[model samples]
Target: MVSLSGSWLANGGGIWMLAAFYGATAAYGIHVGDRSSEVVESTRDVGDAAANFAGFKISTVNLSGQNHVSPGEILATAGVKPTSSLPFLDAEAARMRLEEMAWIKRATVQKFYPDRLDIQVVERQGYALWQKDGKINVIARDGTVIAPYSDDPRYVKLPIVVGEGAEAHVVEIVEALDLVPGVRDQVRAAIRVADRRWTLKLRNGIDVRLPETGLDGALASLAVFDRDKSLLSRDITVVDLRLADRVTVRLSDAAYEARQADLKARAKAKKGSNT
Candidate 1:
């Protein structure tokens, strides 16, 4: 039973007056199916009235774990009006709608009684910058494209990955170089070469050729060589680790000439010692 009070009524209309108003709305001739339909409608209306009287109208909307995406956008996507009823809200559908946004990697929408709705969201993290067709995009760890990179200062410092298949294999490239952060930090870009192998362009303009197979071993060997010989700092143009058994370092023209002169001098000194 619901008690009718003048103060509790909306727009200064009492429940007794409103109920009477609806009661006198129309004259209904007694029919077989009409009575059942009217009873069902009346029952539904009473339930809605009870719910409204008990303060089930939406009053609070709480949001947490949101970043990158604003709360206003989420609420708009949810389509829940300020006076929406908690009973009619589809939490799962609202959650799916919220997750449709690119920035929202995952989300949860829940409606509480006594007029409140809550949203929880987990935003995607920017992993690297992917360049394709001269357009750069911020990519997530799993290669999901977040948004187009357009002079965004936040993503300016991320590692640049290029080529069509680079996004999918970028995780492996980063993982292989994880053990060599010192050298990895100096990497300007990681390019997928011929859609088969990877070539790392170093900050100093040296192109490090990585092998198609046994990448871990090749990277490990490079790490060891770099640590032992300060290989990256030398006047080397290319560091080829394509062959599993040998390391090939291509020198600049000047360095190659200097190396040839030093080898000839050593050969001559050896011949002199023998003579």
Candidate 2:
């Protein structure tokens, strides 16, 4: 042991030694940088095993929020297999893949640690069939085209609309038809023409040509005429409701000739009876 304190040289030497100790302590750091690198390399090996699907299990798969798509189909789309490893699973990538499907509007994917995957889906709502280039396809209310020619039978009764801008105008046509009593039942299909006018093909094979303006009024008038005079029952081929005050009916050639002859004969008979 050294002599007691209060000696100038001893005090000066002790201060220098303390300063050297603090400097060494400051230089030393608690770092796992090398250890982290080794751990990452190990995880990489595990990821390779997972990619090869070796010694892994999918304990739980929770699927929800699906309406049109099945869980199996979703799994197939995600490219996920039961034996796939946790390190190799990409939940976000799987979600993106599932969202690409036609019926899937949105999707969410979550991973619960230790071996569970949770999948959620939002499905698109199909509204009408859009007829384009002579082929009919289903569409959403916002005019997004869904599947083509799906014989799903659930959409069998949905109204089919045709022509340019038909997808945008189909809703309006349906609404207008609602205003006319029995019109919806009688209408087989509605074709929106180039001039923005509509030609309704009736179930009886008759065509009701509506005017560009006042279409609802014309439809209502035709409905009333159909009910009272059985206009639809006649053998007329087309009913042109373009005129404001009067309806111009274009009957079949034979029916027109027969009507004219009957009218003339009735007039002659009435004149003779009065005389």
Candidate 3:
């Protein structure tokens, strides 16, 4: 019985040796195969396949810090496919791809050993709408264009800025308007004139030409006028606030004609009374 047990142990050792040899040969063959053919598959894909076979397949992706961007977009951008493996994933490269998206301000990626990945992203917030050369886009607070206008309600109510160089300087006017919500709320758009000054177009179809300097005081005065005298509700087409001392108003065609006729009638009545 002892001799029989010894023979069995020897045969078991031989079987283990043969298994080791086969494993080494298989690994070397895979290495040679990866180097030999470019058309067969990329090195990354081969590594991913081997890693997956070794029980390192990516089974879970923990994503966070995303709102405007979707999970699918993040996964696609990071190249995390159905067959991706954690052992072969490039975290830094995936981060760069995520940041390439307009909505993503910054991104981070991490791979967990065996079967998990963690992706975090900070998304750009839509600050306003900028229109130039007949095209409109959603812009971030720092003036980066987030995307083209798609009538998304999330950005539809934002203040519209038009003209050249508006996107880069929109924050200035937006902050200025924010100080005076009385004027800001009534504004439909802010047009950048000659890339130097701003002209506020009110919702009531009134164009207010603002001075290049003392913008805050001008907006404040406009707010006062709207608050006290309901100036914005008047039948005026334009309000020129370029001059520091006075506000010049241009009436609509109908209002202008009516005012002219009323002035003429008052003058005739005064002349007849004097006679």
Prediction RMSDs, each to the true structure:
8.5, 17.3, 9.8
Residue pairs clashing, model 2: none
In the range 32-54, model 1's lDDT, one tens digit per residue, is: 23657666445434434544444
All models: lDDT?
A: 0.76, 0.72, 0.82
Candidate number that wins on lDDT, 1 or 3: 3
How much does candidate 1 score in TM-score? 0.74
Candidate that would win on lDDT: 3
Clash count of each predicted structure? 0, 0, 0
TM-score of 2: 0.65
Cα lDDT of candidate 3 equals: 0.82
**TM-score for predicted model 3 compared with the true structure:** 0.79
Clashes of 2: 0
Candidate 2: regions farther than 4 A off: 1-58, 65-67, 79-96, 213-215, 243-246, 267-275
What is the number of residue pairs that collide in model 3?
Answer: 0
- Minimum summed lDDT over a 10-residue window in model 3 is located at 1-10
